[model samples]
Target: MIIDCIDKYELYQGLGDGVSKALEFLVSHDLEALSIGKHEIDGQCVYALVSEYETKPADSSFFERHELYVDVQYVVRGEESIGYAPLQDQVVVKPYHEEHDYALHSGNASFVNLCGGMFAIFFPGDLHMPGISDVPGSVRKIVVKVKA
Candidate 1:
């Protein structure tokens, strides 16, 4: 789990080639104009999903972890609190589907407030529950998938 402002994106270039490309895409593009849907940055190896929706209560969702990809979740508009937990010893609430690429885990997560220009990177070891907010409102967010 890596939490930092986008201004510090430059400091993570050493994360390796795939992650560097993913960061570069976010830094170079005009993400605000992107429509709500999946945009392929480099086919399936690097792609982003733009979405806007009302935030959900954290208790309603479990922390999810992915094995094949790293998630770069960037908030484009509005503020929300997301959940995070370590994957260690967590029980699986849902089995992983290779096609969909995710598995839910049973555990408590600490909350983090994210607003516009902020992003969170969740690798295989980071269990995260996104789309959580204190009030009822919509948030525009982008989740960029980087092949692991």
Candidate 2:
């Protein structure tokens, strides 16, 4: 997992070639102007999903891990918290949905708060429970899905 400001995104471009492409797309575009939907950059190789919604409680969200993609999540308009835990000893609550590329797991997670301009990158082995906030509020975020 990597958490930092987009201003320093260039430092972690070393995450991979695809991550570099994803960061480039983010810096070159106006995310606030993007409508709520999936925007493709490199066919299925890279894409961003713009979402706006109210935040939920931690217990209400599930810890999910993806096998096919690395997530580059950025908050554009609000603050939210995300739970992260290594999947090493976790038990699956719901088996993986190959079509969706994720599986839900039951385990303890550490929470992190992110406001506008902040981003977090979760790799395949990183279990994440997103959309939780300290207080219920609306958040507009873009999750860039980069093929792993």
Candidate 3:
């Protein structure tokens, strides 16, 4: 997992071609102007999903892992705490669904607060629980899916 400002995206460019492409998209485009829906970049290989929703309590959500994609989640508006845990010794609450590329897990995790303009990268082995907060609040986030 990696968390940093969008401007520092170049530092992580070497992670992979897809990751670099995702970072480039985050930095190069006007995320706030994007509509709330999927935006294509590299077809199925890479794309961004713009979504807005109310934050939920941490306990109400479970950690999720993706086998086929690395998620580059950027907060465009408002702030929220995201939970992260290493994908080890965790039990799956729900099996993986290949079409969605995700599986749910229940485990302890550390939380990071991300405000506008911040982003976090979740690799395949990173279990992440997003949309977490102590109090409910609106958040607009762009999640770039990079094929792993």
- The clash count for each model shown is 0, 0, 0
lDDT for each residue of candidate 1 in 101-148, tens digit (9 for 90 to 100): 999898888999998888899997689999997676789999999999
lDDT of each: 0.88, 0.91, 0.94
lDDT of 2 by residue, 19-94 (tens): 9988888888988899999999888999999999999988777898999999999899889999999888888999
lDDT of 3: 0.94
Pairs in clash, predicted candidate 1: none
Which runs in model 2 stand beyond 4 Å of their true positions? none
List model 3 lDDT by residue over 1-148, tens digit each.
9999987888998999999999899888988899999999999999999999999999899999999999999999999999999989898999999998999999999999999989999999799999999999999999999999
Looking at model 1, how many pairs of residues clash? 0
Measured against the true structure, the TM-scores of the candidates, in listed sequence, are 0.95, 0.96, 0.97
Candidate 2: the clashing residue pairs are: none
Order by TM-score, highest first: 3, 2, 1
Query: What overall lDDT, based on C-alpha atoms, would model 1 receive against the true structure?
Result: 0.88
Which residues of candidate 1, in runs, are more than 4 Å off?
none
Error of 1 at 105 (Å): 1.6
Candidate 2 least-lDDT 10 residues: 18-27
